[model samples]
Target: MTAAERIARDFTLLLPPGWARIPLDGRVPLRVKNLVTERVADVPVEQRETLRAALTRELTAVLESAARQGGLDVLLSVAPVAGQPVPASGLVTHLAGQGNGDALDSLVGTLAAGSGTSSVREIGVVEVAAGPAVRRLTTRRERVDGQGDLPGGVLTVTQVDYFVPLPGTRDLLVLTFTTPIEQLAPPLVQLFDVMGGSLRWVTR
Candidate 1:
């Protein structure tokens, strides 16, 4: 099997009850899941389909852009919890920056310390489905001054990075969960943790 296909099979998002999965067409299908009521009476299927279509449009652009840059492939998902105002989105990316562990670490450190970021704290080592991974926590605030659409003017963004080694390959499987801090709740956080922890490499 090809490397991208092999990496794709390594893990899956284990959606809790009331969640439904939607697959978006890309070079590969992007698997997406969202909190949905079992009964059609709760939220009409048409309404949900409309939302899914919109999300697919946005994700397609993001993934396609990433593809233009070498060594990055992604699987994207969207999950909207019951009470939360903003839904959670995820990206599991395979990036081959510098093509080595040490180079990847240095690149992450550089981004963490870069100008726009508020702070990038070292998370050190952690384990994922594939093997040991280096983690980092980064903080940034969105500004409305010259940006696209934001009436409120600012939103705090938090991103947790996991650099997982793809055995016998120079590429790194990057598991990243980025969400606005204020909108993040325990349940959503747990979802990210569970998905990241379940990552494991599959060999043919």
Candidate 2:
């Protein structure tokens, strides 16, 4: 059997309460509508619709952007996790093996070195529930165009990435947690670390 076939065809991870898993599919709009409805339910009846529509549009845009970036799934937290208000998000993407058998460390090193203007905060092998994986943290400034009353400027985005290699293959499942809320980065990253520790491989 091929290495990929011998291992699991997919994997799973644990997300804290209030986290929503959004798959890239035809039902994205429907799913976003549901999420917006639930989140804006507490708003005044007259304002709820307006709020819902705005949120739905913004979220749909984010999900579509992630899909175009090769993300397999997007995990978004609209509520607080563990009593702290964290609106962080995550993206799951896959990196297929080159078949030339490059080592995981070498692959990670190459990725870290290609971060362009982003600063690599940390990179090392870390032990988690799944096994040893490469953990990389980075921060970069991203420009945001002004919209409505919001002024356009650059925002610092912090990201924590876990590169878990599938057993018997050089393929990697990448879990990337990101947040633009720089003030709350510490707690957000701590939550992300716990979530990363909960990753598991599912055998076919």
Scored by TM-score, the top model is 2
Task: Give the per-residue Cα lDDT of candidate 2 at 58.
Answer: 83
Question: What lDDT would each prediction earn against the true structure?
Answer: 0.56, 0.81
Tens-place lDDT digits, model 2, residues 72-135:
7898987655656566899987777731223656767787888788899998778878888888
Instruction: Supply the TM-score for candidate 1.
Output: 0.63
Off by over 4 Å in 2: 1-9, 80-85, 98-102
What would the TM-scores of all predictions be?
0.63, 0.84
Over the stretch 50-74, how does candidate 1's per-residue lDDT look in tens digits? Answer: 6666655665565556555432334
Cα misplacement distance, residue 153 of candidate 1 (Å): 1.2
State the lDDT at 4 in candidate 1.
51
